[model samples]
Target: MAFAVSILRLAISTAVFPIFLLHFLGLWDWICKKLFPHFMVQFSKSYNKEMAAKKQELFGNLHEFAGSSGKLALMEVGCGTGANFKFYPPGCRITCIDPNPNFEQFLIESIAESRHLQFERFVVASGEDMHQIADNSMDVVVCTLVLCSVQNQEKVIQEVHRVLRPGGAFYFLEHVAAEPSTWNFFWQQVLRPSWFLMFDGCDLTKESWKPLEKANFSKLKLQHLQAPLSWKIVRPHILGYAMK
Candidate 1:
């Protein structure tokens, strides 16, 4: 059984590295737009429903936060291939930051050429330092699947808190370590070294949740979900909203 598990892991890793390379090369755009927007949109739509429901549940308690002033100043930390561009609400001003300048250039060029756009504005830099966004001014900050690769998660979380207005919301999608999964635990431990070095220091099992809870968010709306076929090894995600 152990030998079989090892072989399976090797096979998975071999297949996984190519996908990582595509992400590193920022080629998800070509794949999503040319080859797979249909599948991508469907998956995102499914997640959006669940995420929106999570947000709506606490609308009453979070009126001040959820109630935007009809104008949104948004930021996407680690924007990747700008996948979240399709998720933005109209009229929201956007600024996205990513360490990979090459990727950022690609994102800007894509937006310039593309027909459909959901973001209001876009920028390329480190999200940990939103030196451009004024303090207590932004309406919403979209941080989907970003915290994992950040070197200083605490610093960035603090920065997010600092930039948000008194009632602004920071909506996030994150993957953290899973519970009670022995094989998953092993994979995280075994691959910790290579995963980080190869993928901008993104550890599959990094704990980015506790600090967010401890942050200045007045109300936190959080949910966890596991992906279908991760061998129950890779942590799936938690989509949540926190208000300043």
Candidate 2:
């Protein structure tokens, strides 16, 4: 019966909640990679050339940027597994930050292989707190599927604004809450509590579009870009950019 299944789900989530709390404290990503390296690897493997090509097309068009020749600096907050590595401009410097202990090593190793692009850094820092870097120090700030887990999304937006120069841009791809329907809403409410446990601090339903709009930035450009905007939806990601 539906009631029995709901009870079973609740019981499972109740058991997993504590561990999730620790994950929010930045523990689960490490454990998932350690306990299930292949799973994590498989996840990364699927993030293939096509996704990178799409990202390149979108961001490159948004910023009118294609490749790097001079000394330009790029940074990605919450850079998971460094999938954005390929998109890094040749002959440019890149920095990535993520709190996942399991990812830090892999990120460094993976990105360092790019002969044309230099790995400037990859630190374990919260996206909201990039105060250590000087203001207006970056040419571009990139974020992809990263907003869901951040505890203070507002602060992160502020930090992005702070870090970019006046003409600089913040390019992003984010999944968010969708329009309500009967069955989709029903299951999202039911499974989100349990499902969030497995994702690296992802939220099934997040209103992530507002922060960038409200931030102190000029020339905002957004696309309501989540595929399957209504049906069988999980990662209804909003992807776009804002000029700072």
The most accurate candidate by lDDT is: 2
Give the alpha carbon lDDT tens digit for every residue of 117-225 in model 1.
4455555567677787678766667676578877778888888888888877887877777664566666765566455545455678877678888887899878777
Top of the candidates by TM-score: 2
Q: Give the TM-score of candidate 1.
A: 0.69
Q: How accurate locally, in lDDT, is each candidate?
A: 0.63, 0.72
What C-alpha lDDT does candidate 1 achieve relative to the native structure? 0.63
Name the weakest run of 10 consecutive residues (lDDT summed) in model 2.
61-70
> What is every candidate's alpha-carbon RMSD to the true fold?
6.3, 4.2
The residue pairs found clashing in candidate 1 are: 94-121
Output the lDDT of residue 187, model 2. Answer: 66
lDDT of 2: 0.72
